[model samples]
Target: MSGSVAFADTTFIRYPRPAAKVDSHLDYVNELLTEALAFSPRKYQLLPSKATMQQGRAVHEMKNGTGEVDLLWSMSTDEREKNLIAIKIPIDKGLLGWRTPFVISENRQMFKAIKTLRDIENYSAGQELDWPDVKILENNGLKVEKANSYEALFSMLEAGRFDYFPRSVMEIWKEQEVHASKNLIISQDIALHYPAAYYFFVAPAKRQFAEDLTNGLEILIRNGQFERLFLKYHQSSIQKAGLKQRTVLELQNPFLNPANMPLSRTELWFKP
Candidate 1:
């Protein structure tokens, strides 16, 4: 039996719940893996794990080769820098072409009081500990709270432990509706922005197989198979909302430059 693709829950930009069970990234991996298997007859598999890393420590453990996973999908550039063993997977244009608003929230009640970074100074900001974004909040003298996971932060918020949290608008939109009566609201001011490229980090031990898989994926994308799959699951409204008047770059061309991939060289952290 072939293994499955490994994934970490992104909850927002990458692994939204609706698409979690049958994500495009997984499809891409599988399609490509099948091609590789046809040619090489490798008994390889794509394992999917629900490991959620909301902090650098968690990322370190996984990237340091201690985790029970062969790949981590939809990781950030900062993560790549931490571990070169991570193989880069192709990201959909939907991810690469957009940036969403950053939001602030707390448990029991959402924090809509602060409008800007400067306004947050009087309030405590809860984020993934040591997250690069915290520096912007801290520069303005805002109290920053670091947590290990989203569950932990939500607990603290519900207990009235923290004042606010920074997160992507998409995450807030989806999660808030589910946790709505739970009192989580987003802010009007945009805090930070990042490209929407999601990736799969392949374990170094399986680099050759991963590279082969990547090549197959590149073929699928060039043939528009990936986009067809993407449209099948795309929610019209959500898709519209996600890509309003934005340039949707097709990641199909082999001649495409690295800059075309929305590649960035900045530190990143999930909302913890």
Candidate 2:
């Protein structure tokens, strides 16, 4: 049985950073939250809070702790020991998602000569400090330089201050067209890979509420509604990557269609 969970939206995805309005993982969470309200009981209405800390702030406040959120969803193993309840989710599959790297230019002899991780390892690499990808590269013995800002990396990479700049493919594409880069090149080998998910964190004071939420998730799974949500979003990315579409199955007894779900019963709980 799977658990139902709510998660704070992840701020970053494979998109441009400086854009005033950026698409975030939180957007999907909010959408699911809205839909679940109508299906679940009234007492199960979960709320999301805005992050109070900005970049450079310690992640301590974000970590699960006593008197803090009851269950933090989709956290790493390191975070679970700190106060988060682990809810096993289906993330081991490539279905989790991917974010590729983008470089600033592709013209210089140094850039033209590079195509893979081994090539970049021969020179100084620039990336955001403490980022997961940066840590991965460092652990692999790749010499990487940390940058404070994406803009800084662009400047450094152009000035030959650094050998390469690695960032999310979508973000780099959104900021500058990759084909337009005459002085930089994206690396061929992936710097790192890990399971990332939007998870729920319950304040210790609201333990019961968290349990109820988990129960709701189990109901969704039992009813086969859990998979619909994932597949709906999953198809878009698959198509974008030129992959075949997946078939969705209503794999439960007494299956029901979410689209045709009547408002009568749901209205008693969540009002539109």
Candidate 3:
């Protein structure tokens, strides 16, 4: 019998949850892995478990011989890369790096005067306590508050506890729609730019799995399947973000490790 490759079901990564199906992100990863493994001599069964992002990270870190999970997909950071093997291919084509703010509709005017990173530093931002982006924002001289729950961050923003909540361009629209009644709106005037990429991570000992994933992604890219898959799920979100109209406030990624940089792979990144 072929061994099974297990992964986490990161529910928060996408929306429109079907009553009895995996989210689009997990589905796509499974499809890509299947296609990749088809070319190799090894055939493996897939096992997906319902778990939060933090829970998945914990299981991956344990790296016990039990094989609870074979992989995880998350934002790449220097520390994570050192602890886990990262397949450096950016799954979203760098879309996650382009961010817009979620502000109380009444406070929308607060960001109007912000034209540069320096100007934006004066405002406070909210992020999940464990997110690597917290350090990235602070490194750029911006003040950030922490929240333990994803949903709680919206409430914090609504209460004016933080000046703004920065979310990815592809994520803000759906979030804004869901929380519209909360009196929050995506800021239309500016988009924050940083070097961020999400990658598939596996235990350090799972080098073969990491190699298989990278090979599969490269083949998908070369055959154009990757682009097709990306557009199918993200095109609508990207179009709705109206990136061209927003002023781009660029910031440096302090957590980027030199070994994990993917800038030379232009075809693998989305340009907008």
- Scored by lDDT, the top model is 3
lDDT of 1 by residue, 1-272 (tens): 12222222111111112222223344544554465344442345444445533335434544565544445554345545346343444444323223233233433233334334454456676766645445534554568787765556655665666766655433444545555555555544333343344555565555665666566656655676655644443334244344333222221222223463434522111211
The per-candidate count of clashes, in order, stands at 7, 20, 0
lDDT of 3 by residue, 1-272 (tens): 12222222211111112222223355566676667666654444555534444533443443542454567766788877777777888887888889989998998788777778888877899998877789889999999999986778889999989999999876676677667679888888888989988887776666766676678778888889888888877888888788898889998898987456788989888888
RMSD vs true structure, all candidates: 9.7, 13.2, 5.3
* Arranged by lDDT, best first: 3, 1, 2
Stretch of 10 with least lDDT, candidate 3: 10-19
lDDT of each candidate versus the true structure: 0.45, 0.41, 0.74
* Model 1 TM-score, 2 decimals: 0.56
Structural similarity to truth (TM-score) of each candidate: 0.56, 0.53, 0.83
Which residue pairs come into collision in candidate 3? none
Superior by TM-score: candidate 1 or candidate 2: 1
Q: Whose TM-score is higher: candidate 1's or candidate 3's?
A: 3
Candidate 2 vs candidate 3, TM-score winner: 3
- Residue-level error in angstroms, candidate 3, position 233: 1.5
Q: Judged by TM-score, which candidate is best?
A: 3
Q: What TM-score would candidate 2 get against the native?
A: 0.53
lDDT of 2: 0.41
Best-to-worst ranking by TM-score: 3, 1, 2
